[model samples]
Target: MQITASTVSLTVDDVAASQRFFTTHLGYAEQAAAEGFASLARDDVAMDIVLLARGTEVLPADQRDQHACGLILAFTTTGIEHEEKRLRAEGVEITMPLREEPWGERLFQVTDPNGVIVQFVEWATPPAAENA
Candidate 1:
C-alpha cells in the first residue's frame, strides 16, 4: 500500500476559532466545512488538518467529548527563527520560546484557541552516534 497524505484530526471546543487560526496564521485553506467540522489543506505543503467540534457525532461515543489534550502537532521546516519572528509580528503568542537542544533541534511552540500545541522544529547538523 502507499500513503499519499497525512492529516491530524483535532477535537476542539470551537471549530470556527481553530479554522480561523489555521487559515489566518498557517496558510491553510479550507477544503471542506460543515456545522461542526472543517477540513484544511495547504497548497505549498502536504500537511492537512481537520478540526471537529467536541461532542460532534462523527466521533465515536467514548471519544466524542474528549479534547485534543497533551497532543502536539509538529512540523519540521527550515528557517525556524524567521518563522518565529514572523509569527510574533502577526500577534501570535509564542507559548514556548525558541531554543536549540544539545542534539541540534531548534524549536518553538504556539497554542491554538482550542489549546492544541503546534510546534515548529528545525534540525541542525547531527553529531556522530555514540557506540552502545
Candidate 2:
C-alpha cells in the first residue's frame, strides 16, 4: 500500500484542553472526534493524536511518568521569521529560538500544551546551489 501521508499519535491528559490549545494557538483544524478522542490536522495532513480524560479508559496507567516520544515532529515553512515572531507574541514557550544550523536550516522549536515538541524549519541553502 502507498502511504500518502503520516501522523504522530500522542496520548494527552485532557482532550478539550489539548484541542483548544492546538486550535487556538497552533491553528489546527478539528477533523474528527469520537467519545474520548479527537483528531486535528494542518493543511489537510491529519495528526494521529488521541486526547482522553486523565481518568478515562484510554488513559495510560502510569500517568505521572512522562511519555518518551521517539521522533520530533517538524513542519517546514517558507516564512520562518514571521512564524517565530507570531508564536512568541502568543506566549508560546519557545524551547529553541530561530537560528541557522550547521546543515544550513533556519529552525525553531516549540512545545505544545501536552508537551509535544513541534519544530518549524526553513532551508537556508538551496540544494542546487550546494551542488554547484
Candidate 3:
C-alpha cells in the first residue's frame, strides 16, 4: 500500500505548551487545534505532530493520562552542528550535547516544554564507503 502521510501523537500535560514550542523553535505551523488537542506540521513530507492533553477523553482509557516518554522524536538532516548552535542561541536547552559515534552518526537532543525529547542527527559516510 502507498502511504499518504505520517504523524506522531503525543499525550502531554499541556498541549498548548508543546504546540508553542514546536511552532516557535521547530518550524512547525499549526494545522488544526481544539480545546485539548493540536495538530502541527512542517512543510516537509511526513513531519506532523498531534498533541493531546493528559486525561483527554478522546484517548483510550488506559492511555488517557499517559505522557510521552521513553522515546525521542528525531529528525535526520544536514548541518547538525549549525542546528544545535541555532537552537542554543534561541534559548533552547540542549539536553544532550552534540557528539559523534564511531560509526559516523552525529546527534544531539533537546527537551520540549512538556518533556518531549527531540533529537537531530546527521550521518556521515562510513569510512569504508568513503574509500570505495
Candidate 4:
C-alpha cells in the first residue's frame, strides 16, 4: 500500500478550543474549518490533525457521542528544555515538569483546553552500566 500522508482525527467536545491550542501554541496552520470541524497541518511535521466536535453527524452514529480521552499526543523533539522554557514563557501550564529518565529519555507534558495530553520528549545519553 502506498500511503502518502498521515492524519489523526480527534473527537473533542469543543473543536474551536483544541483548534486554537494547536495553532497558537504548537505552530499548526489551519487547513480548513467549519461549524464543528477543523483540519490542521504543520509545515515541519508529516502529521496533520482533524478536530471534530462531539455529536457531529460526520462521525459514525455509534461514535458521535464519544469524546477523546486517555490519549497522549506526543512529539519527539530536539532542544526539549528550550521548548519547555518557551512554552512556560507563553503562559502555557506545564502539567508534567521536565524530567530525565535513567534510560535517557527527557520529557514533559501539557494539557490542552479539552484535556488532551501533549507531551514532548528528547533522548539523551544512556546511563552508565554498573560494575558487578
Q: TM-score winner among the candidates?
A: 3
- Per-residue lDDT of candidate 4, residues 1-132 (tens digit): 998789989999999999999999999999999999999999886479999999999899999999888898999898999999999999999999999987779999999999989999888863353322
lDDT (Cα, tens digit) per residue for candidate 2, span 37-131: 77877775545455554455555667534352555768877788999999899888799989999999999998777676789988998767999
lDDT of 1 by residue, 26-110 (tens): 9899999999999999987657999999998899999999999988999988888999999999999999999999977889999
The lowest-lDDT stretch of 10 consecutive residues in candidate 1 is 123-132
TM-score of predicted structure 2: 0.77
Query: Regarding TM-score, does 1 or 4 come out ahead?
Result: 1
Q: Which 10 consecutive positions of candidate 3 have the poorest summed lDDT? A: 122-131
Q: Estimate the overall C-alpha local distance difference test score of candidate 3.
A: 0.93
In Å, residue 78's CA in model 3 sits off its true spot by 0.5
- Cα-based lDDT at residue 85, candidate 2: 90
* Candidate 3 off by > 4 Å: 126-132
Q: Find the number of clashing residue pairs for candidate 3.
A: 0
| C-alpha TM-score for every candidate | 0.92, 0.77, 0.94, 0.92
Q: What are the lDDT scores of the predictions, listed in order? A: 0.92, 0.74, 0.93, 0.91
> What is the lDDT for 5 in model 3?
87
On residues 1-132, what C-alpha lDDT tens digit does candidate 3 reach at each position?
Answer: 997889999999999999999999999999999999999999986469999999999899999878899999999888998999999999999999999999889999999999999999888774578789
| Ten contiguous residues with the weakest lDDT in model 4 | 123-132
